[model samples]
Target: MIDTNQFLAQMQEVLEIEDRTLSPDEKFRELPEWSSLAYLSTIAMIDDEYNVIISAADFRELQTLGDIVRAISERQP
Candidate 1:
Protein backbone atom coordinates (compact mmCIF):
# COMPACT_ATOMS: atom_id res chain seq x y z
CA MET A 1 0.00 0.00 0.00
CA ILE A 2 1.17 3.52 -0.80
CA ASP A 3 1.47 5.73 2.22
CA THR A 4 0.26 9.30 1.84
CA ASN A 5 3.07 10.63 4.01
CA GLN A 6 5.62 8.97 1.78
CA PHE A 7 3.90 10.48 -1.21
CA LEU A 8 4.13 13.95 0.33
CA ALA A 9 7.79 13.47 1.13
CA GLN A 10 8.59 12.31 -2.40
CA MET A 11 6.70 15.27 -3.80
CA GLN A 12 8.60 17.66 -1.58
CA GLU A 13 11.88 16.11 -2.59
CA VAL A 14 11.07 16.02 -6.32
CA LEU A 15 9.49 19.47 -6.42
CA GLU A 16 12.01 20.91 -3.96
CA ILE A 17 9.26 22.16 -1.72
CA GLU A 18 10.59 22.89 1.75
CA ASP A 19 7.28 24.09 3.09
CA ARG A 20 5.87 21.99 5.87
CA THR A 21 2.40 22.90 4.66
CA LEU A 22 2.71 20.28 1.96
CA SER A 23 -0.43 18.20 2.07
CA PRO A 24 -2.70 16.26 -0.20
CA ASP A 25 -5.26 19.04 -0.01
CA GLU A 26 -2.79 21.54 -1.44
CA LYS A 27 -3.03 22.56 -5.06
CA PHE A 28 -0.19 21.00 -7.05
CA ARG A 29 -0.17 23.88 -9.55
CA GLU A 30 -0.07 26.60 -6.90
CA LEU A 31 3.35 25.57 -5.65
CA PRO A 32 6.02 28.15 -6.33
CA GLU A 33 8.27 25.45 -7.77
CA TRP A 34 5.60 24.17 -10.08
CA SER A 35 6.69 24.16 -13.70
CA SER A 36 7.00 21.94 -16.75
CA LEU A 37 10.09 20.43 -15.24
CA ALA A 38 8.32 19.82 -11.96
CA TYR A 39 5.47 18.18 -13.83
CA LEU A 40 7.86 15.82 -15.56
CA SER A 41 9.63 15.21 -12.29
CA THR A 42 6.37 14.25 -10.67
CA ILE A 43 5.56 11.89 -13.51
CA ALA A 44 8.93 10.26 -13.19
CA MET A 45 8.66 10.01 -9.44
CA ILE A 46 5.28 8.29 -9.57
CA ASP A 47 6.42 5.97 -12.29
CA ASP A 48 9.54 5.01 -10.41
CA GLU A 49 8.11 4.80 -6.93
CA TYR A 50 4.57 3.61 -7.57
CA ASN A 51 5.19 1.80 -10.82
CA VAL A 52 2.25 3.70 -12.22
CA ILE A 53 2.43 5.07 -15.72
CA ILE A 54 1.24 8.65 -15.83
CA SER A 55 1.60 11.04 -18.71
CA ALA A 56 2.33 14.76 -18.81
CA ALA A 57 -1.17 15.45 -20.10
CA ASP A 58 -2.65 13.51 -17.19
CA PHE A 59 -0.52 15.42 -14.72
CA ARG A 60 -1.72 18.66 -16.30
CA GLU A 61 -5.29 17.60 -15.64
CA LEU A 62 -4.64 17.06 -11.96
CA GLN A 63 -5.70 19.83 -9.60
CA THR A 64 -4.53 18.79 -6.15
CA LEU A 65 -1.86 16.61 -4.65
CA GLY A 66 -4.62 14.37 -3.37
CA ASP A 67 -5.57 13.65 -6.96
CA ILE A 68 -2.20 12.02 -7.44
CA VAL A 69 -2.59 9.93 -4.32
CA ARG A 70 -6.01 8.85 -5.49
CA ALA A 71 -4.75 7.99 -8.93
CA ILE A 72 -2.06 5.72 -7.59
CA SER A 73 -4.29 4.39 -4.86
CA GLU A 74 -6.88 3.26 -7.36
CA ARG A 75 -4.22 1.47 -9.31
CA GLN A 76 -2.97 -0.36 -6.26
CA PRO A 77 -3.66 -4.05 -5.92
Candidate 2:
Protein backbone atom coordinates (compact mmCIF):
# COMPACT_ATOMS: atom_id res chain seq x y z
CA MET A 1 0.00 0.00 0.00
CA ILE A 2 1.22 3.47 -0.74
CA ASP A 3 2.00 5.52 2.36
CA THR A 4 -0.54 8.28 2.89
CA ASN A 5 2.00 10.36 4.79
CA GLN A 6 4.44 10.29 1.89
CA PHE A 7 1.63 10.95 -0.55
CA LEU A 8 0.40 13.91 1.46
CA ALA A 9 3.90 15.23 1.89
CA GLN A 10 4.41 15.02 -1.84
CA MET A 11 1.11 16.79 -2.27
CA GLN A 12 2.24 19.55 0.08
CA GLU A 13 5.50 19.82 -1.78
CA VAL A 14 3.74 19.96 -5.12
CA LEU A 15 1.27 22.53 -3.93
CA GLU A 16 3.73 24.44 -1.80
CA ILE A 17 1.38 24.33 1.16
CA GLU A 18 2.13 23.89 4.82
CA ASP A 19 0.41 22.24 7.81
CA ARG A 20 -1.02 25.47 9.15
CA THR A 21 -4.53 25.97 7.80
CA LEU A 22 -3.85 23.51 5.03
CA SER A 23 -4.54 19.86 5.77
CA PRO A 24 -4.97 16.59 3.93
CA ASP A 25 -8.59 16.45 5.05
CA GLU A 26 -9.26 19.97 3.84
CA LYS A 27 -10.79 20.60 0.46
CA PHE A 28 -8.31 21.55 -2.24
CA ARG A 29 -10.59 24.36 -3.32
CA GLU A 30 -10.52 25.68 0.22
CA LEU A 31 -6.76 26.03 0.02
CA PRO A 32 -4.42 27.89 -2.35
CA GLU A 33 -4.17 24.66 -4.35
CA TRP A 34 -7.43 25.49 -6.04
CA SER A 35 -5.76 27.25 -8.93
CA SER A 36 -5.77 25.89 -12.46
CA LEU A 37 -1.99 25.49 -12.44
CA ALA A 38 -2.17 23.59 -9.20
CA TYR A 39 -4.73 21.28 -10.72
CA LEU A 40 -2.41 20.65 -13.63
CA SER A 41 0.42 19.92 -11.24
CA THR A 42 -1.80 17.57 -9.27
CA ILE A 43 -2.87 15.79 -12.44
CA ALA A 44 0.75 15.41 -13.43
CA MET A 45 1.64 14.09 -10.00
CA ILE A 46 -1.18 11.56 -10.00
CA ASP A 47 -0.42 10.39 -13.49
CA ASP A 48 3.32 10.16 -13.00
CA GLU A 49 3.09 8.55 -9.57
CA TYR A 50 0.09 6.24 -9.92
CA ASN A 51 -0.35 5.78 -13.66
CA VAL A 52 -3.76 7.40 -13.31
CA ILE A 53 -5.13 10.00 -15.68
CA ILE A 54 -7.78 12.34 -14.36
CA SER A 55 -8.71 15.96 -14.91
CA ALA A 56 -9.11 18.93 -12.64
CA ALA A 57 -12.84 18.70 -13.20
CA ASP A 58 -12.63 15.16 -11.88
CA PHE A 59 -10.87 16.41 -8.81
CA ARG A 60 -13.48 19.10 -8.24
CA GLU A 61 -15.94 16.30 -7.56
CA LEU A 62 -13.86 14.96 -4.71
CA GLN A 63 -14.23 15.95 -1.07
CA THR A 64 -10.65 15.53 0.04
CA LEU A 65 -7.21 14.09 -0.67
CA GLY A 66 -8.51 10.75 0.63
CA ASP A 67 -11.08 10.89 -2.12
CA ILE A 68 -8.41 11.74 -4.68
CA VAL A 69 -6.29 8.80 -3.58
CA ARG A 70 -9.29 6.53 -3.86
CA ALA A 71 -9.92 7.80 -7.39
CA ILE A 72 -6.34 7.07 -8.37
CA SER A 73 -6.62 3.54 -6.96
CA GLU A 74 -9.93 2.97 -8.65
CA ARG A 75 -8.40 3.84 -12.01
CA GLN A 76 -5.66 1.27 -11.48
CA PRO A 77 -6.03 -1.91 -13.50
TM-score of each: 0.85, 0.79
Best by lDDT: 1
**lDDT of model 1 at position 23:** 85
Native-vs-model 1 lDDT? 0.83
lDDT of 1 by residue, 1-77 (tens): 57998899999999886757588899988878988888878888888888898665765677998899988887765
Question: lDDT (0-100) at residue 38 of candidate 2?
Answer: 83
The residue-by-residue lDDT of candidate 2 on 20-67, one tens digit each, is 534558677777557778878888888888888877577669988877
Which runs in model 1 stand beyond 4 Å of their true positions?
Answer: none
| Residues forming the 10-long window of minimal summed lDDT in candidate 2 | 17-26
Residue pairs in candidate 2 whose N, alpha carbon or C atoms collide under 3 angstroms: none
